[model samples]
Target: MRLGSLAYEQIKERLLEGGYGPGQRLSAVELGAELGVSKQPVMEALRLLSADGLVTIIPQVGCEVARYELQEVQDFFALFASMEGTIAGLAATRCTKAGLRGLDAVSARIGHLASETDPVARSHHYRLLNREYHARIHALAGTAVVGEISHRMWDLSDFLINTSGADHPLHAALDARHDDHETIRKALWDRDAGTARREMELHILGTLSVMRPQQL
Candidate 1:
C-alpha cells in the first residue's frame, strides 16, 4: 500500500479498536511517530478519515475523533434499512449467478463464525462477512446513483458499529444477524424480489431493536 493509505488503515484500525475515545484529539505528529511515518502521510490519512465522518478537522485547532448522537444513530440505520431493502430487491432480479455464489460463500462463512467460541474472533469475522454480503448486493443492484449513496451510508454505519460498539451480548447479536442473513440469502437465491425486500427491511429494524435502549 502507499504510505498514506497504509497510515490511514493503521490509524483507522486504532480508532475502531478503541485506541482513541470519542472526541479525543489526535496529534498527527504523535500518530506519525507511533506509526513510524512522516507527518505528511499521517495528515493525508487524517483528511481521508475526516471525509468519512470518523474525524473532525479544524483549520487552527487540528483534529479530533467524531461522536454520534443516539438519534443520529437511529436515523442512520433507518435510512440504511430502506436503501438496503431496495438493493436487496434489485439483487433478487439483477444479480448474476456468480454474484449469487459470492453471496452464498459469505453467508457460509458467517454461519461458521456464528458457531465460533471466541467473541473477538467471531465479531471480527462476522464484520467481514456481513460487509461483503451487503456490499455485493449493493454492487449488483445496478443503480448507479443509489448505489453510490448506499456505499457512503454503509461507511458511516460501519464506523458507528465499530466505534460505538454493540449494546447486546456479542453472541446473541451474532446469532440474530446470522438468522437474518439466512432469510435474505434464501430470498435472493429464489429470485424473490418482494421477499428479499421485506426480509432485509425486517433484518435491519430487528437489529435496531436488539441494540441497547440507550444506543437508540
Candidate 2:
C-alpha cells in the first residue's frame, strides 16, 4: 500500500478503536504528522470516513467524529437486532456442517477468554470472537445486502462499545453476551430457525437494555 493507503488504515483503526471521541475534531495536519504521513492522504482518509458517517466534514471547520443521539442509538440497535435475527434464522436454514464447525471454534475461543481477569483484555477478546462468530453466520445466510448492512451497523456498534468508558457498567452485560452466543450456536446446530432468530434478537435487545441508559 502507498503512504496514503497506510495513513488511511492507521486513522481508520484509531477511530474504530475509539481513540477519537464522538464529535472530536480530527486535524489532518496533526494526524498526518503523528502517523508520519503527509496531509494529502489524511485528507483523503477523512473524506472516506465522512462518507461512511463515522466523521463529519464541515466545509470550513474540517472534520469531527460523528456523534449519535440517544434515540439514534436506540433505533440503530433495534435495526441491528432485526437484521441479525433474520440473519441467524437464515443461517440456521442454510449453514453447512463446515460452517457450524467454524462457529464452534470461535465460540470455544471466546469461552476460554471469557474467564480472563482483566476486563479490558476480556472485552477486546470478546469483541473479536463475537465478530468472527457473527460474520460466519452472516456468510452462511448468503445475502449480500444483509451482510453489507450488518457490517455497517457493527462498525457503529463497535464505536460505541469501545468508547463507552472503562467502568461503564455495561461490562457485565458484555460478559453475558458470550452466553447468548452459545445459545445461538446451539439453536443453529439443532436447525431450529425460529429459536435461533429469537435468541439472537433477545441477545441484541439485552445489549440495548444494558447500554442504553448509560449512553450519553
Candidate 3:
C-alpha cells in the first residue's frame, strides 16, 4: 500500500481503539511529526477517516473525532439486528455441508474457551470465533447485497464493541447468544429452514436486550 493508505489504516486503528475521544481535534502537522511521516500522508488519512464517519472535517478547524450518542448507537444496533436476522434466515437454507462444518468448528472452539480464567482473552477469543461464524453464514446466504450491508454493519459494530465497557450486560448476554447460535446450527443441520430463521431472529432480539439505557 501507499504511504497514505498505510497512514489511513494506522490512524483508523487508533481511532477505533479509543486513543482519541469524540470531538478531539486531529492536527495533521503534529501527528505527522509524531509518526515520522509527511503532512501529506496524515492529511490523506484524515480525509479517509472522515469519509468513514469516524471523523468530522471542518475547513478551518481541521478534523475531529465523531461523537456517537446513545440513540445513534441504538439505531445502528436495531438495523444490524434486522439485517443479521435476514442473513441468518437465508443462510439456513443455502449453507452447504462444508459451510455448516466450519460454523460447527468455530462454535466448538468458543465452547472450549468459555472456561478460560482470563476474561479479557476469553472475550477476545469469543469475538474472533463469533466473527468467523457469522462470516461463514453470510457467505452461505449467497446474497451480495446482504453481504455488503453486513460488512458495513461489522465496521460500525467495531465502534460499539470497543465502547461497550467490560462491565456491560452484553458480556453476560453473550452466553445466551452462544446457545442461540447452537440452536440455529441444529435447525440448519436438520434442514429445517423455518426453525432456523425463527431461532436467529429471536437470538438477535435477545442480544439486543442487553444494550439498555446505561450501556448505550
Candidate 4:
C-alpha cells in the first residue's frame, strides 16, 4: 500500500479500537511523528477518514473524531435496517445453492464462536463473522450500486457503534443478535422473501437498543 493508504488504515484502526475518543481533536503533526511519516500522509489519511464518516474536519476548527448523537445513531440505524432488509429480500430469491451453502458455513462458525469465554476472542470472532455474513448477502443481492452504498453505511455504523460514549454493554447483546441470524438463515433457505426481509430488518433495528438514550 502507499504511505497514505497505510496511514489511513492505521489511523482508522486506532479509531475503531477506541484509542481516540469521539470528538477528540486529532493533530496531523503528532500523528505523522508517531507514524514516522510526513504530515502530507496524515493529512491524506484524515481526508479519507472524513469521507468515511469516522472523522469531522471543520474549515476553521480542524478535525475531531466524529461524535454521533442519539438521534443521528437512530436515524442511521433506521436507514441501514431498511437497506439491509431490501438486500436480504433480494438475496432470498437470488442466492444460488453454492452461495446458500457458504452462508450456512458462516452461520455455523458464528454459532460456534458465540459461546467463546474470552471477551476479546468473542468480540474478534463476531466482528469477522458479522462482516462475512453481511458481505455474503451483499454479493447474493447482486446489485453493485446498492452494495456499495450499503458497505459505506455499514462502515459508518461500525464507527458510530464502536466509538460512541454509551457504555450499554453492547457486547452482551451479541448472542441475541446472532440468534436472529438463524431466523434469517431459515427464511433465506426457504426462499421466503418477506420473512427474510422482516428478519433482517428486525435484526438491524435491534442494534439500536445497544445505545442508551440521551437525557432530555
Give the best candidate by TM-score: 4
* 1-216 per-residue lDDT for model 1 (tens digits): 999999999988776544576788999999999999999999999999999888999899999998989888888788889888988999899988898898888888788875688867776677667778888888667788887887677666656765665532335588778888888888888999999999998887676665555576
Off by over 4 Å in 3: 17-20, 29-36, 165-173, 205-216
Clashes of each: 0, 0, 0, 0
Question: What TM-score fits each model?
Answer: 0.88, 0.91, 0.81, 0.92
Error of 1 at 179 (Å): 0.6
Better of 1 and 4 by lDDT: 4
Per residue, candidate 4 scores C-alpha lDDT tens digits across 139-201 of: 888989999899878777666666665542345667787789889989998999999999999
Tens-place lDDT per residue, model 2, 1-216, is: 987778877887777667888889889999988998889999988887777678889998888998888778778778888889999999999999999999999888887874677766666666666788899999888888989988877877777666555343334565587788989999999999999999999888676655545674
Q: What lDDT score goes with residue 194 in model 3?
A: 80
Q: What does the lDDT read for residue 107 in candidate 4?
A: 88
lDDT winner:
4
Model 4, position 47, has a per-residue lDDT of 99
Model 4: lDDT to the true structure: 0.83
Write down the TM-score for model 2. 0.91
**lDDT of candidates 1 onward, in order:** 0.80, 0.80, 0.74, 0.83
Between candidates 1 and 3, the one scoring higher on lDDT is: 1
Clashing pairs in 1: none
Inter-residue clash pairs, candidate 3: none
Q: Which stretches of candidate 4 lie over 4 Å from their true place?
A: 166-170, 213-216
Residue-wise lDDT of candidate 3 within 32-59, one digit each (tens)? Answer: 9877899999999999888777888999
